[model samples]
Target: MSTTETNSGTAPAQSASALASKNPATGDVISVHAIQSPEEVRAAVERARSAARSWNALGFDGRKQHLLRWVSYLLDHADELSELIHAENGKPVDDAYLELVLAVEHIAWAAKHAKKVLSPKKVAPGLLMANFSAVIEQHPLGVIGVIGPWNYPVYTPMGSIAYALAAGNSVVFKPSEYTTAVGNYLADSFRLANPELREHILTTVNGYGETGAALVTSGVNKIAFTGSTPTGKRIMAAAAESLTPVLLECGGKDAAIVAADADVKAAADAIAFGAMANSGQTCVGVERVYVDKRVSDEFITEIKKIIRDLKPGDAEGASYGPMTMPSQIDIVRSHIEDALEHGGRAVVGGADSVKERYIEPVVIVDADETCSAVVEETFGPTLTIRTVDSADEAIELANASRFGLASTVFSKNHGMEIARRLRAGATSVNSVLGFAAIPALPFGGVGESGIGRIHGEWGLKEFTRPHAIANQRFAIPGMALLSFKRTKMTTSLVKQTMKLLHGRYK
Candidate 1:
């Protein structure tokens, strides 16, 4: 690993005109893309704005036809796309395929349900205004600017891309520099699937931070970003200048609770996979655990057995693959050293587990709450376990982190109760990441984890706004409350009605 050369997916600008995409495992250049300047970004947004008009004119049924065709295209090209994901993103080919499967599920959900979810519906006009019929209509925001991450390039960005498109809006996406070619392929496939449609319905802007900054202020109606918490904050602050709405999915130090009643073997297996899968680059991956003292030793022993056998490589039978970003290697290394320096001990693998690009799964026990490994978002294959006296203690420890993204509970009898007690946007009971596979559930985090929800009904609604319409049926001349010519008798009647309906409750 070279300290002087590090790329965080969203790396600094190397050339004024081009960005190269490279394979993380072999350091081989996959492809090169042209950097879109600020002027080019604006032009792209304008094109998208024009495309949005035609897109919305197609209506829900027409759009669904196109989206479903896109789904077919994705399925047809699954092998080719998965291979690209494996080489550029440094994840196992099977893991890449699973990511694609989840992404396809979201795309299908957003397409099949958009019309029903976004249709105008009658809203009740209460007794105070019974003469008017009211309805709320969903209106699509013109153009959306999406800034995506490299970890799960297809799945993560498609959360925004699929939902936004279904809601009748055009999009301009700025994919991470590390996976530029993969991003381009997604947009290109959309056009290929629907050749009769306009090209500007979806587009890509290639470059580093400057390209992203330009998109935020490119006269787009909304901006959706997925990355670190610090980057989320900066994007929010910049978007505030134009009052551009943002949907951010940021960093998470997610935790899991293992109760004494949990199935020991099942809990251990799930934890082992949850913590180390995708090289632990998942934003919602399990990084910490709190187990009851009675079951702590057993859980640790079972998990260690699983970790010792798993290996990371680009070979045919590797458990996982190399770290996608070069710079993240340093962060993972420092966290392990910090954990050991602060009196925490590794029961499985220690600092030596961290190699140049691949990191062996390390499990730390007795780590203090203040240790960097426990406190920060370590994008590596590592775990920190602490013993607790009861479920109350476990819940308290799990909720102590600044992030409230996702959590899991392993309990035979009290899993649901414990999950409800934990502070998180989503909770899985006796399982890991159950909510992610179900496209009907919305996914997002609270606090430092970022704002807004994606997937399911809420995900479709995020790209549109409501418009309320009130149509008058008939006017009672004497009881016209909104008119200046209302008589004293009507005012007296209105006062009496108000007291009868509301004032009596007190």
Candidate 2:
């Protein structure tokens, strides 16, 4: 699972002009990947465009077999792929394995449901056009360019890649520079699975942000981008140059609400895992928790017990690994400091918890709502607990952020009621981040969190456009409705029908 092995299997070895992928935990150079120039990105998009027609012609069944084969290939090599994820992303081995499992499930789901979701279906022509037979179908948007994030690199990106391919479009992926090796490994595996179509199918363009910018404007039919909000906006703007539609999955300041009747222990465990897993680098990771005032003390006690002994390091038994991005450490530190300065009390770790690369879990209580720690996305293993007078207040506070990504509600009753009230893309009742594990659920957010969705049927449609067709069944005798020779009798009949349908409804 060495970097050279990963890169060589898919394509030729990286040339001298390449970027180094370093391990965030140890600061070791894990692999060298060729930095694709803008020209190279455009070339990859062109290749995908050329291959899309034949791939789509294979139809749903043909594509399903190839995608299922990819699933099997990925499952067979899960351990190896997980190792690459660990080496590059600094996540614990088990976490990386879980990510791979979810990614495989998404691919399988997309393949199995593509036809059912995207196939043409008859539609009623309405009374005004009863003589016409109408239908609608989803057609591939040609080539799709995906800009993936580093955290959960495999799972997050595949949400776009798998569905885009399932819907009959060729993909040109630009993985995060930090996880270039992992991306190359996936592309290589896909090529191996479909060797005959390798030249026209999935392609990987390894590089930094500039490479991603190039991909956005690479003349692809559409772009699916997952990253920070600012970056998502930039990608959208770049794609606008080509009028290429973009689906953005951006950052989230997700919140978890605990009702008075919730099971304290279960809620504590779920929140702890949701907040600290992957060192809190998840896009929908739990960053805030609003609890009922009646049970705030009990909830805090239970959560503290769950995380008190947890450690953050690269050790075998550590709860999580180091921060994937070095710059993120400063962000985490600043958030913790701001909370403490704004009338917040640290229940677990605080300013001293942030190390060179690893950040011990930090839990702050009673932080001011306006503080940066509570208002912005920290993307670290930090949680801010704020007590609310009632469930309504909790919902209000949760919906206060500009981000409306994902949320969780823990309650013995009224879970669904509260979940529906939260203005987020998805909500998990009685659990944290459970929506992500369900392949059928759509994932994305509203407002500043970004637009569009990935996963299930929504994901299939995101990479396609609707094409409607209508056929005239039989023309009425002497109708001439569409001709200059339209008869007065036909006009009178049509007017009378419209009046009968609408004039007396009330």
Candidate 3:
């Protein structure tokens, strides 16, 4: 652990307690970040709150300009940011670069669409209130606190950060301790793009769980957290103490279903990338595959061929990078071992694939539905394949999990139909993890997969509170709806009108 100070003059002095961000590839420290004290966290939130008054006053146009400038800054230094992400999170340079590209796109989407999505809109006053005109608009929620994850550090946090800012709210971001440098880099860049509003806009707080807890109760209007389900629950509880609302993008056991008429080779290739990319550390990564028994053998053979030469290492040309979190290796090993112990067979790499920082890509077949490998979120380079008699059976098994973040269905004839039946926040038909790249689509999960959404119009609204206004455009003759001077005849007439409009309610 070490400490560093904020470049902004308004930032509080660096604290003695600090945390180290390390390279999972070689177990070397990449950077050290100062852990903000609870008091410091409170101070940052107050600053953001003060800034929000003027920021919200900037309206959509002003905020959009600044956000786009931030986007420009990110693109100009994309290579440097990607390298920082690679060194800190242990993902390959190419993967890190891809994450940044997607993040930049999201920033642009949020900036371009925020005004349209959140602007005030006129609505009908309905028959009962025909004399009144109604309008609804979204108002910024002051400061937003974001707790980000290490896997896809840049992209995941930016999902909330960009949307929050675009919605006209200041943000206080807490990046994962494992990738604190990347988080700081983003905040620093944002300041450089908008130096006048540097202290009032985006700020980064770096540390482990305690620091995150401080942010949770730091009086921010809302908290957006991305991490494990258990951690999400903890954040929810902490925010409860202050009655603060939270948006959780938690864990997932996402599955891919291969229909009888599916393209086996294409499904295999897609599933391989979905499960092995980022070393399968993705919250929406394909952890389970339920294939039609008719195509199970062919599907397995295709996937085996696809990943046969794939390996996980920190070397050039490797299929993927090492596991970002060291302790995750044990979880990966246990899941593989449990699957084997419970009558599963490894069609590709097995428990022996687990190493210090890298677990070779593994594809297990016939894993029991109740086994940890198939049931729990094994955030590693592993996939469990189960054979099902029909698409209905696959849907049943896929929905059996308590988590429902995302799922994919591959079928030429029934792709869309099967996707409709799956219980997930977003489903990809004929493709894998495709919904994530579409900014207009809302992304979030139901049940233990987490709450609320990010991206698109829904994301913009998530960071805003709706305000409705009604104005009387005219007065109805002989009507005294709220007047003490209302007569018995008026009341009788109102009752008759209500019954005429809703007598069917009986």
Candidate 4:
């Protein structure tokens, strides 16, 4: 209900004391504002539902105009927005800019591709149903509830948010408590460009667990959630009460495989970014690196050199930023301790590297399979290096996980082949997290990594429902049926036709 303007003039900055947006680098409060009460949350949803009806009525072209406005607004304030994201999330400024660029690209992709992918298509009615013609199309699901994560705060949430909007649905976003300010900024900016859509298009609610739960229970037609596997399960269970459909992008223990034929320097550089960028807080960040024995020594040496060049600080030249969440430091420390206890060797930095708010990158080898560092989601700046016999063995180890969000393969000889073998939502051949930037690719994972997808066609459909219409042509009464004398001949003809159409083949 209240809107404020920041430097970009999107919205006024909320007082950090009231809402509390902290600087990940210094653990200082950036700003804060009022938290929305349950009643206010419901009211927002109501406004969105009302807006959805009119927005949907605008049809394809009308919705596209609104999307373009949002894109323009995002581009106009990208620098200021990126700075805000960096300050709040502790990711490097470049990485923050990258997220903003990709978020804008995704908006463009969703706007341009939604109609083509979701439009009606005619299907053959087959055999006994030959007299009927069928068509299937997507319909808006009304209100969508999005619960986003802090990592890649802009792009991650926008995956669902943009697609939901493209599909003609209103969204009420509840971003991670750690990144609420960014969420508020995005929602407020969207309203500014399309004030006519203020009530219907987008809204933000700030809080922690209870707030997220309330959004899931606010009678939204669908929910799109991105977070840890444990929390994803809880969201699913909560939505079951309302039978609301959900799309979850959960945790991942994603691995980067280095083949014997890989360029060691390139491989090491890729691993460094995949593992240490954003202080290694990405859900799809490289947690483990498996190299062929033939290249193990060389790969480790190369990775260590890159790791040594990295510095953790709050400055521009620093390769790594501070941990966004303070509690994450303890978890990172615990994982390092477990890895050491299990006979792991720290090739670079170690436990003492954890500062008040920043965590330096630590590379460890000889990590036991059962060690928490190897098995759990540290979500910090750390990497475990392991060696295997061949690409097959590398993939085998990589696929052996409860989480399968994303992966990377660095084999010049057979990168795509090996990448295809990993059980993950997206795999980048010779690159890290490259698939995330391609708005055409559907993003999500399988098994414990979570279900459903966001991005591309799948993302658009996730927030909409199928509206099937079958128009009856004319009443066709068989000559035998008109007399109400269903003869054996007519029955025999029907049976014969069914067999001819659907009989099992040899």
Candidate 5:
């Protein structure tokens, strides 16, 4: 995500190894981070491997204490951290705090629920193995390498990091190069919170793409990345050499569907906020809307009215701040231009609304489904509204994209029905982004949007490996099917049982 903006402040990285963190709104240099070399990344991984022993030994309750302490520290320093996030990520301070709140809540959930979700569980032994007792135990997967995004820097990466750590694994975090300072602050805060814990329980490695590549191949137990689909493919390929597993939360061209029966005003407000919040950098941010033709007129008018007056700036009461990644400004401009060139009309702000640093909310109506602005992930404060004859047509158009991430539906009568029919990992009914705020729901995508879930009982299990134990409680005389001394009678009995259990279907 930090990669969204060039280290050279909207340009490419320089020959110097140090990374300069700048304000996207003002181009002010906040700080410079020393890029870690491949060797350094390996060393960090080794340290995590060593620290994993102690981390695992802590058990659920022991680890929970430290994680909660870290949460307390974050809360105590919320203002400070939010300010840093505002400066580097260009989000409003309140929005930054909201991101932190969600992240902290997820960490707390992972900590308190890890034991319940991951503890050993008894299982019934089959009739053929009646003498054996079966139990499934979940164990920490040693070390986790997390590649975070800058869009929702705190909330996104913490989804993986907190769950991984609470599940009993040590972590090596590579924050987006843009949010390097915030990442280091997090790792440092953990150490400060639990003074007794040694280094490597949680660590950070700073750099651009090279550092992340080094981490993928540095023999971590698994790599959890949140970024573009192409980068995810490359990481998967590189991790294949050693066969390390990966959990990728890639791009999303999320959509919102407004049915005819929906409350037009409510739908408009939620979708408008979802589309432009935090400058629309959210992976699950709404980029397109499919409305029923019967209500499309009112829905369009309402959304346009809501966002027409919205302006972008770093000043107080601003709708949203400037684009955090300078490179993204051009993409937003291009999407607006492409849409306009392809029979789309901008009802609110047009191509000129995209400034050097800030992008005002732009609403382009009647964009062709095949256009880039409609199909691709613009990652900006823009939305495309399309009118469909019916909810079925709306669903068809909404699911047309290769991405199947998060989507929203606003229909008092058919909200649940439309949500269930969506081709997304999570669908919010009646409100936009409802799934993201709930800690119990696991979040991820089916196709290019991403692979694997990360926010619930499933999230806690993502960083663990299951170990099944089968112990013999007693042995049946003359029924030693698994022993070398098994008789012909035992074999015949198994065949008869199989036939009785499975051959009657015909």
Candidate 6:
């Protein structure tokens, strides 16, 4: 690893062209970044492409070693990385550190398991191809273009990046317009660990929508994009021009069900954290809550108490920071207003909580299904509470949304039963967003929640293509359709064999 730094310790001045990263809590400038041009992005992709060939040729053991070294580096410098994440994304230090920890685990998981999961496995060729032996292997798809979002920036993107690298594909990462500095820090750290593979291994382009579009159209072999559903659709369309495959991780209107048998306090606390942490910028954050009518009043009161205790600021002592994106303030305001206008009550915080860059936790109750706050992906520190007669009703309401990323069931019994009917990719019983922490479980959703899985063995295969190869072991004359010669006797024998093999009746 070289101490050689490219454009470190120096940043573009705070000008019109600079993307200024602000502290979500205090609204102070944490760093300034220059949005790279399209040509510069092209160069970065080309460098990654060159690096990928050599990096990919290193075989599984060599790649695993490099990944382990990278993990070691992250552990050695965990504090520094945590601070950078906090400064860039405006979450509390604990949240940042936790994300870094999860990322480290993801990196290690991808490294240690990629070989076993992606390597070829023998399969029976079957009676049709009885003379052949077949094997299926997952092959690297070459360069992958990754577009990340701001919330859990490290954890979310690494789900794609680490897995892609493990699958032997180089990545050209373009982080959110709001969190470019975090992207830069990660890419730079990788270079520090694997200097020889620096060019082919990783490269970052920091910018906004234009930069992301450039990456999507940059002729990469595949695109792994995580953001809003609309953006995911756009990325898919752009990649369609090149017929490039994509793994889209998009938005969610996730719900948390509080059954009659659930603990009110525990459910409330889970709701508070799942909705307000990261200022609710998380894709799988719980935006809607369906509480049993039997416990609706008690649950709402407890949840309000939890929201009241959550303080949002840029100070060191705060639990959460501001909305990282300056424009999100308006979005948050609009959603709160829409809820209020629709007869919803903000029991704790309301439109008044929407500050310049920060938003206090808002818990809205009596929200109708048609309200935007209840239906839309309100990526803010706000939640909508609804009541239903039974757990079945809760599942029905949760599955009604087009987005089905992750859902939670809080019940002493029937938790798993209700979870199964939710139509989401993942469900956490008696917990919120707990599936994401388990490295072995697949993480992703069906429908609008996005396409493709991002964690576990599924993640490792998302960046690779399954290649099936068959070898002929022996030849049987007149045993199959390979020859058009006289085969009346052979045909009778084949039909009898087929019937015996399949155990079919007359």
- Among the numbered candidates, top lDDT falls to 1
Clashing pairs for model 2 are none
The models' CA-based lDDT, in order, is 0.90, 0.88, 0.87, 0.85, 0.89, 0.84
Please count the clashing residue pairs in each candidate, in the order shown. Answer: 0, 0, 0, 9, 2, 5
Please tell me which predicted candidate would have the highest TM-score against the true structure: 1
* Residues 78-129 of candidate 5: C-alpha lDDT, one tens digit per residue: 9999999999899999999999999999999999999999999999999899
| Per-candidate TM-score against the hidden true structure | 0.98, 0.96, 0.95, 0.94, 0.97, 0.94
Model 1 TM-score, all chains together: 0.98
Better model by lDDT, 5 or 6? 5
What are the per-residue Cα lDDT tens digits for candidate 6 across 338-448? 999998988888999998878888888887789888888888899999889998888889899998899988999888888888899999999888998888889988998
Weakest ten-residue segment in model 1 by summed lDDT: 1-10
- Per-residue C-alpha lDDT of model 3 across residues 1-506, encoded as one tens digit per residue: 11111100111222469777778898787877778888999998999898878887888899889989988999899889988888888888888889998998999999999999999999999877889999998999989999888888889889999999999999999887778899999999998988887475889877767778888888999999898777788788878888999999888999999999999999999999999999998888899999999998899989999888887777767788987776677778998999999989998988889987788888889977788998888888899999999999999999999999999999999999988988899999888889899999999999998999999999999999999999998888777787888888878988998889999786
Per-residue error for 190 in candidate 6, Å, reads 0.8
Report RMSD for candidate 5: 2.0
Candidate order by lDDT, highest to lowest? 1, 5, 2, 3, 4, 6
List candidate 4 segments past 4 Å from native. 1-17, 477-487, 502-504
Off by more than 4 A, model 5: 1-12
**Residue pairs in steric clash, candidate 5?**
1-150, 2-178
lDDT of 6 at 315: 71
Task: Answer with 4 or 5, whichever has the higher TM-score.
Answer: 5
How does model 6 fare in lDDT?
Answer: 0.84
Measured on C-alpha atoms, candidate 4 has an lDDT of 0.85
